[model samples]
Target: MSDGYSLTVELTRGGDSNNRDKMRATVEADTVDELREKVDALRDEMQEWADDFRNIQPEYRRELPDDQSQLGEVQA
Candidate 1:
């Protein structure tokens, strides 16, 4: 008598079920509607993370010369 539903998924690239990654979890709820709401919330949180990751940028700067003689003076 299980009160919750269990889900197990395996992902394979080349049709080899044995050589794949697996994820298993159980969702507990009083009703099917509750389960759907929980799953949708999870989806929304994942989407937020994806949106944040898309905004990454690199900072760039030029290195100063180690030798003072090699450095050039700035013009006004």
Candidate 2:
């Protein structure tokens, strides 16, 4: 018996023309725990892409919380 999952993640470019970014990947594992590990790895990769996008477009970047949460919230 074999257990595995095939998933696709998509992202949209923010600009004049909207373009699609498609990422197709597969995770093969014998157990659920192993599958979770594989999924976490995939999630990390997606997060890196998001970080890169924020870096490229300063206007769409999200503000980070500072030591003074109240002040940061107010500024935002």
Candidate 3:
């Protein structure tokens, strides 16, 4: 059996050529430890973004009810 580990993602925004981006990285090592190190780094990066959501300003964030009463305004 073979263990495969690699990731590639393409991103495009606003139909702008300048906004096109691609990330190509891989873990080709046959050892599990090396793969864990790579995966841990990815986890850390993703966590940083997760941590950022709290720092975003209220206006830039999705709106939520100010109280139990306001929650009904968005109900279907």
Candidate 4:
């Protein structure tokens, strides 16, 4: 007979703010060492994803003229 071990891992980015990202995985192994290895791999994957996410730039909307009468004027 053999023993089985299962683990669940969750990683999150920007936890302090409203915009947040999360990653989760479940790993299983016959030994504690194997379980730890699987969890490490999952953590590495999550970290890579977080690094990539950090490189992305936020989009902003273009601002319009504040004066309503100037809206009809053409630019040179």
lDDT of each: 0.52, 0.61, 0.53, 0.79
Instruction: Return the lDDT, model 2, position 72.
Output: 38
| Number of clashing pairs per prediction, in order | 0, 0, 0, 0
Identify the superior model by TM-score, candidate 1 or candidate 4.
4
Q: Which ranking of candidates, highest TM-score first?
A: 4, 2, 1, 3
What residue runs in model 4 are displaced by over 4 Å at the alpha carbon?
1-3, 63-76
Cα error, candidate 4, residue 64 (Å) = 5.0
Using TM-score as the measure, name the better of candidate 2 and candidate 3: 2
Residue 53 displacement in candidate 3 (angstroms): 2.3
- Please provide, for model 4 over 1-76, each residue's C-alpha lDDT reduced to its tens digit, 9 standing for 90 to 100: 1579998887777855656777778899999999899988888888898898877766976666666455457576
Please provide, for model 3 over 1-76, each residue's C-alpha lDDT reduced to its tens digit, 9 standing for 90 to 100. 2776554422222355543333334444456777687767876765565456435543555567566556556657
Best by TM-score: 4
Comparison by lDDT, 3 against 4, better one: 4
Residue-level lDDT of model 1, residues 1-76, one tens digit each, is 2676443323223245543333333445667787787766665755665455445444666766665433465444
**For every model shown, what is its TM-score relative to the native structure?**
0.39, 0.44, 0.35, 0.64
TM-score of 2: 0.44
Q: List the residue pairs that clash in candidate 3.
A: none
Task: Please write out the lDDT profile of model 2 over residues 1-76, one tens digit for every residue.
Answer: 3455544455554455443344456666677787788878988987788667556633566555665555435653
Tell me the lDDT of candidate 1.
0.52
